[model samples]
Target chain A: MILLDDGCPDFAGEMGEKTGIDFNRCLQCKTCANGCPFIDGMDQAPNRIIRMIQFGMAEEVLKTSTIWVCVGCNTCSSACPMAIDIPALMDGLRHAALDRGVEIPEPDILNFHQEVLNTVKKYGRTHKLEIMMRYKLKKMDLFSDMGVGLKMLKKRKLDLTPSRVKDMKAIEKIFQEP
Target chain B: MKRSSRNLDPGPSSGKLKFSFFPGCSLKASGHENTLSLLKFCQSMDIDLVELEDWNCCGSSSAHSIDKRSAKYLPMRNLSLAPRGVPLLIACPSCLLRLKSSFLSIKADPALRRDYEDFFEKPFDDELEIIHFFEIFNRVDLKDHMEILAGTLKGIRVAPYYGCMLFMPPDLRYEKSHTGIIEKSLKSLGADIVSYGYANRCCGTYLSVAKPDIARKVVNEIIFKAMEAGAECLVTACSMCHLNLEIRCTLDNPIPVLHFSELLSMALGAEDHKKWFPRHIVDPVPLLKKRGLLA
Candidate 1:
């Protein structure tokens, strides 16, 4: 029940421009799908997303959980017979999805990424504790993972203080730049 | 497998191997023990690591996935921070990929190089060698210390969980690789390598934070597989993978996951388990003690 936008017919070409990967070269051999460890969590296999881009199904492809669920592990791209950078493709799609203001199938993942960048923007490095607390605050369901959080604290896996870059002006400039 | 491994480059000039080290966010903030043991191992091997001054994030998976510009700038800034001539050694696998791929891109394009130089207010050194910690193995021969280090790791069974480090984008496919470097280096150190199916399985990184269920599933599978393969402990090459493996596994009595550097430090006769082992959720001390690796 999805219709291709005859307007942006070269969606694959557009993605290639964004990620520097030629999606048209994908053989659709399912090698990427077979090797992807997070395939079960992905609503669609990676190659299907590539095919969607090829067919100009931008809305469908951008809205899929596959892009957001991908941790950029590079399992598929490494095994890709066509040698396509599948993870790079996912990154491109996720950016595109965010840019275009489409519905994100995995809002939690998006929230996590935002929390991570938020800390980096502030401290010039990631603070696991802050990222977690901020994410839980935003999600407003922190108690669910309290056990794991407590465990990490007990093991000192999550640090109370962020190891920051000495020159805040430098990182401030990078984050502020257009 | 179509993934090709490359021959390693020559070791550094005889005595002291000094280089700039970027410990990325994972090690810098959370994995202090990984940093400590890594420094210990490097010192024992006479590898002097000068930490990169004011190095920022490497555009971790989160950066590239959300904002393209932040991703480019993060790694670009780290590149600008690298000292000239001496290679910049990144400790995290993901950071290595992010920085290395960006370096290759800047190297491949002239205009982008100028833009990067202009933005960062630093010259892009074409000769600046960006390397991973594994690359140091090519320069240091563990066998040379066998007289003192022998029998230190003899009875320990380790599963080397590379966890997606080897399976990077094809753009970097032809670059120098560290495939089987862990197994090769550890075997020479006398630890038994236990082969497992899930050694290369992705540890479901940020998912452990966002989608714990999926991360939990994959983590348990990896740990269970390693245990099934008779591994007494796991040696992970990545800090995030080490964290995820320890935290996400829901199995009862999971094996201790040690950083590759920690194991190397132990085998090199660096007796500092007290500093490193307590940080681990699953303490490797009991296993190391049982194997006579500790007094």
Candidate 2:
């Protein structure tokens, strides 16, 4: 009861070759989807994403919130009977999505990712207080986790100052390369 | 146990099992309690955990999702800095997975290895063994030590939560069975092991911060499942799992969440327990006090 799409481009093969995920081996059993914690929040389930890739539906796959929302928890990959590295494949898809300049459905998550990198780039290590402050300012939800933040501060869990690595240039170099 | 042929002794000789410790970002920050407890526990075990010189971020989930190159390169840089023979001891499961996966990726592709060397301006020898601290604990014979500490944790029912990262992608995991080492360690410490269905379940991770509603639903399920199984406390190896469960769970009567290292330290009779336990959002001391583990 499935229609053949011989004309479709081979997104699965490209992604598989890049990440060694073997998307073709996916059985459509929905095991990965069933085990996924965020399946309900995802626009397409993990298995559906794999199926879309197999059918070479790159644009649709890239446009969905599935890749953005995927936590890279590796639950799906661990449960996959095909032994497909679904988390790595998801990473590859996110890379592809960014490269293709596809619209990211989850802008806040995207912003958070960039901000984390930026925080690390600036401090060589992540300063939780600074990162949280910047993230809140960007997201404009400064009060969301303020209670927990206060608790962390009182416990001396949050370092007031940033940790600087001796070789800041080396960290900068890693960020600059490619 | 072949020592590194290289003469690079980065830290003072402790005449013990030496490892370059990569605490990752969380350990230095929100997971400070885990760091303090782990350090104290290691000191007691006589393991010399030298901090990796100029260690940078592992990029965690952010770099991996955004750029494949950064994901591999960030951890690769840390691996390159590690001494030739000493295994790298990573406390955070996220860092362990990233470092191990990156090591495997470079090993599988010579071209990628060459590119990394050229890019980092350092030799890309995949000789460094990346070992998680949990694995290190597993190797240590805690049986003798347990006898002394057994009284502290006796009769306390606990659930061991192994979260998703510690047992995933086969090659990177410490054990095939998710809770094997943890369960063994808990039993050795004289605690009642509560069998829970969601022991290896994901705690919704970063989503707990980015999307709390979704994470709360998952966190609630994990907590309720443990409580339903009669577990008085939940101990986890991953800091993110600890954070999610402690912060996100919307339970009226939430159980205490403790890092395995903290529990181990307590059993080993770590004094000034206030230093580590206070950092927890849901205080674990009340439960420990109720169990007669703490004064």
Candidate 3:
């Protein structure tokens, strides 16, 4: 299912245009994969994703868990000999994936991200407790990390109330954009 | 990110240095000990860090990962709020990346700067200085404040875990980096830094909650390596790393994770360990007491 399809030949070039990075410079030497701390969690080695992009396998690359699993720590980009902005490439791919409404390989991660944005939209800042609660509520799996949540609460790490900004109009102006 | 040529303007004892501090959500909400200790450290060094008033989140990982527009605007809003002619000091590495990259982007592109100005309804100040907490060290030597030149943390052994601080994105390669500042600073304070391979390893951030299994494995590995290398404790620069390392590590007899601010304040004889120590999940008091660093 993950094999290459030559239908989207413009994928790599378009990504280059979007991110201002040249994927052609990638040596495929796997410097990024080797340096990535999250490599174990990814389905594809970071290099393979680049190869997939170069081959115009847009759907496969978009659907892969590697893109979502990447936290954009820039470990790969910094270590890259070709100086390819691999994380930027990933961001381009992610935005493209969302635009196309493709099947997300990692929905929970996306859900978590959405929840964080939701908090920021409401308060003009991230409310960790609210984000965590809503994220767990959406998954209907709140019990899994209850111990860690309680520990954080006990430590006063998670605030009881959200830190709000007075300029709601300014926050609204930012979030109201398409 | 170029360091000012005048790194040594006035020593810590001579005058007060003022910086508009941007304590990201982590330090503001969850990392009480970190904030308390950090403020204490600044007060002792004659450095006055004024909080950025009504400052919002710097888009964080959420904005950039999914929403491009929000990412651009979130950090831009914070930039608009920056007071004229003063350095904006950010403590979180992730927050720094978001805000600094946004600043650099606007500075390089006149169109983006115009858009930012038009959006925020304020004129863009290109001369605004955005710096990190570590930048304070670059401006002064902590030894000036140390009454005993022989280092305050003489008996404590610390493992400085950077966790995604040194390796920045390509766009920010030219920015001033904090390479070895942790080890160098702590060493100057008399703390022996343990050598470990996983000091630069990623702490698996949000994954600690979304995919705990994966985060668990990585956190355990990092802790195990530091402990294996004879580190009595681990010190981190980011509050998120401190949270993830403390929460996700399932290993037996885990070493305490101290914020860099805590160690710095302690070494400088702040005498407020009682307020900070109880907040830690893995208490450093027993270890510090055993080493005679804390009584």
Candidate 4:
């Protein structure tokens, strides 16, 4: 059996303060877990996460791969009986993890996040080929996917050339703005 | 096919169907053709649109991920500006959802709503409707009329991509019915709809900029899925999705990407194929010519 308190804050109290998650009204109906598509795969289901977070397990809460696996589909939040913003809460945890500089559970997850920002930072807008090439190089097994790329090329679905917008500065500004 | 016995055209009504048009930033820049075609289609069908006076980006997948308030505020400002009676008509589903979710969050908590409303000059009442462009096309009997236009779409297998928004959270649909609105809408225009699962898959959109490796993986999955589904070309409703899928082919062949309206305008015998043809990374002219639709 799981410890009820475990040196964490009340489930309902911390949720309202930190993540804007409304756990006080949770009916414990498990509707969210049932509707959550990712629940089966999750070690701690959405409801449990809310419960754990409510108990103030901030460190342990932010250190799991569960946050990354969330597709952010909002199905759980949509189905929550208490209308708990579970998806937003998950995002909150992700941000908290980043702020604390905690080691992410998966290496690929952080790389994916960094790659996205890099592309946006570089071109103001992402160039598909550049993003793909960078990703392949970083992953260190670029040629493993080369066959698929060649096939797509043969079918004329993947274009080698990329064209940038004339007002690239405007795009840059959007990203650069504080 | 449900054939319409009477004139399906919704005759002039007493009250105009008013909605704030949020043509997300990409449409203003690279998606001009798409915006134009959508405008033309709306006009051709006698639909009224009230575009927001000075709209900006919805802060897309990146801004929100980076900072929540900043991302939510951008869409919130637009939602606050939306006309009261009609639902806000958004061309981009991602923007629609973001705005809708923000609005939903506000309504669920009055204090937060008031707090944010104060952040804006004018106080918002949270009585706005955020709708996708697809919703307007499917409202009431729009699809029935669209079916009449379907006989024109005979050739060309179009891979209709839905990206990650249009049908997520499950409640945003206009008609509340089960139908492949995108594909069926195109089919009504006489295009062969390629059946595929990737139609609703994420284009690795947020990943496109934030996580290239994952973005590449996701995009490649979309491409392979579309090809395996037998699509001659891919048609999308999202510009971001278009960007990710279009520029990735770094070889001799590239799949041509076109907005749904670009294809429809071609089939409806409206747009100039030459001008639009050269602009696309993939050549849609041959396909159009093969169908004897292009001059």
Candidate 5:
């Protein structure tokens, strides 16, 4: 029920840390995992994570790489017989873990997501160069993608200067607001 | 939601053919040509396009990825603002899905529907139907009108690219069968149409910023698929798809990407092809010139 509510924007009148979670209805079907193409890379498949939640194994659920790897593609949500919005729950779980300052299974992946957010927050949209600079400055090895980036730059596909949306502060407010 | 008289204003025009235009962010930004050409076509076709007032972004697939309700509400606010009982013409597939998904969910829940009504200035009557601009173009008899362009694009072959957004989530209801019609439209303008496997491939969308490495890999696949299928040029209905596949890629095997409108506009000789064509990261200018259409 909480998952359904959180997924529906009409009920977002009051924002809170508990974005919402509805875990009671999962039937232990492996369909979400079976249907997921990214399942092989995940430590806990969607079904196993749901089972972990059902078993009150919050620590296991929170710590697993499953939440980070979730593409939020709605494949799991679509395949779930219970029609559980597993993608949204996974997003919620990710936020839950982040709020608690838990280290992600792959720090680089989390850093990448955060880099995007920071870029968008700063310029309202990202420029390839700015993103690369931030990534390299934060951790050096990320510059390895530059071989490809330089090639694209020569072709004028990757602009060195980042573009900004007009009134970026308003755009920033949209992201910063609850 | 209380239905106010202002929200009930039957809009500036009335007929069996009226559509509220929801130009997604791309249309306002880089994809402005698609929107302009679409409006021009609508004008020529006598279809009244009512623009929604004070509309914000539909949040595209981003808001939905982070929060489902934000996705629904983001689109719902726009849907509620539209004139009731008119089919909404969506240019962006992402926006169409966001609106349609919210609409379907609202009908399934009474409390939520009622709560939505209370929040909006006008009560949403569940009367708004989402339709794509492409659907309108193909459904209407534009054959005679398109025939005028038969001599314009003499020898260019276009592969119609739908990308992933236009076909996914099962609810957008785009007729995959329209491939023939799209081909016919281009051919009517005197361009040869090619078949390609990348017609429905993913373009790494927001991931272009979110995960550049993954995005590059995904975009490479789409490009390779298009080239492998023997398409000389690629045409798309979505601006973001065009931007991603044609503009954002790091690939060397770049093909010209044309918005369906730009292609049609070129055929009509109504487009300033130089302004639009060269701006693309992968210039389609050479392709047009090859066909002697870019003199």
Candidate 6:
């Protein structure tokens, strides 16, 4: 019982303006959908998502797991006949979803993103062990990758100590601005 | 202003080519081998890789997904700190993509450039070249060195995995296929380059963490494709790709995955191959020993 035209706003135009990718140039050739590795899991193929955006289906586009599932591999952008920056467009949608406070379908994915940012914000560089631990705690999936984590630790690949950059205040300021 | 790869000068005419090195996060953590091998390779070639002074995170995939401005500014901070006139050489392809895209984005828009300058308190210079470490192979004449090391890599059939970031969004890519330089270098080292279908395929990246099933599927396909083409090992430039290929590979017999730099350094007679090979999830030592590349 989803109404495509009832509350659909000019999502595509705003997104295009924000990301600088002209959705109008998409040839509907399915090249992007064909090349997407996650298309099978997607509710709508990438090409269809673009078409939905073009049709101003803001709610449908925003609510779908498409944005969250996209790994930002840039395969679609490379395959696009029109050379549209589809990966950038995907990033813009993720940002827009955050701005609108849309509930991301994949909470773990959302948590992972936030955890990575929090680690970077605190240390000014990503601490692999800290980031992974925080992400697991946030997602409460502690035991899933424990074995591999232990292996990484044993190999000394995941250092326990966090790297400290000199300009902590500057990094904090950059996060504060805009 | 599109920078053509051809216009890039090959090698440093001077005694040493000095540049700031940004190893990103993975280089210090999961991809320590890449850092070790790259440093060894640089030392052998008389290249000076001064580590960037107190470099911060480039925001990577996370910042770009949540906040657009932070994504641009975080990497911009690193670019700003990079020494003027000295190109910034980055080992991770993901870092290169973030830095290069931010550079292009700011250059395309003036107000955005002003905002970055105001935030960073430093003038944004578009002239600064962000070079990927793989591109350095293209610049150096490795023919003679390869001849010297040819015996080591003889009979090693390798599949060069370019992953996705090395060539994408048209401009950031060093070359269209992005595997030519790697393949050429491996060939020069006397290794057989296997023609595989998924050479440029996505390694499912962070998706391996977010969605393991999807990641496993993609990694399996790449692995099988390489094995089908008779490759004993998979050589890649990106750290993430190396991680994904190794971690998600559910193959019955997984092939050894080595960063292209690892193989290059090993071929160049790096004394401490043992230091880096242990870092690999899929041990490459057995294959190397079998081929008599390692004693």
**Which candidate gets the maximum DockQ versus the true structure?**
1
User: Of models 2 and 3, which has the larger TM-score?
Assistant: 3
Instruction: Encode model 2's per-residue lDDT on A67-99: one tens digit a residue.
Output: 888887788878788887787777788889999
Candidate 4 or 5, higher DockQ? 5
Clashes of 6: 0
lDDT tens per residue, model 2, B1-295: 1224244344545445777889888887788788888888876776667788788889888888886656767888888888788788988888888888788879888898898888777887767778888777656677657767765687789989988888775656443343478788878778899998898888987787678889999999999999999999999988878887887877998999999899888888888578888788888888998988898
lDDT of 3 by residue, A1-178 (tens): 2232343448877887899876667788999998888887899999999888878888999999999999888888888888888888888888999999999989899999999999999999889999999999999997988999999898878899999888888888999856
| CAPRI-style grade of the A/B interface in model 3 | medium
Better model by lDDT, 2 or 3? 3
Tens-digit lDDT track of model 6 for B43-68: 77756777888888899888989876
Between prediction 3 and prediction 6, the one with superior DockQ is 3
Q: List the residue pairs that clash in candidate 6.
A: none
- State the displacement of the C-alpha of residue B47, model 2, in Å, after optimal TM-score superposition: 2.0
Candidate 3 lDDT score at position B1: 15
lDDT of 5 by residue, A1-178 (tens): 3342445332122112243444556777688888664565578888887666655565667789888766555655656778776766776777667766776775655666556555555665544456556766776675565565555555444555655555554454456546
For candidate 2, what is the DockQ-based docking class? medium
Residue A74 error, candidate 5, Å = 5.7
lDDT of 6 at A41: 65
Off by over 4 Å in 2: A1-7, B1-15, B170-178
Output the better candidate (2/4) by TM-score: 2
DockQ of each: 0.77, 0.70, 0.73, 0.12, 0.14, 0.70
lDDT by residue (B133-209, candidate 3, tens digit) is 98999997777876573567875888899888545767678988787899888887788989999887889989987
Full ranking by lDDT: 3, 1, 6, 2, 5, 4
Write down the RMSD of candidate 6 (Cα, Å): 5.0
CA RMSD of all predictions: 5.4, 3.6, 4.4, 8.1, 7.6, 5.0
Q: In model 1, what lDDT does residue B177 have? A: 78
Error of 2 at B282 (Å): 1.2
DockQ measured for candidate 5: 0.14
Superposition error at B41 for model 5 (Å): 3.6
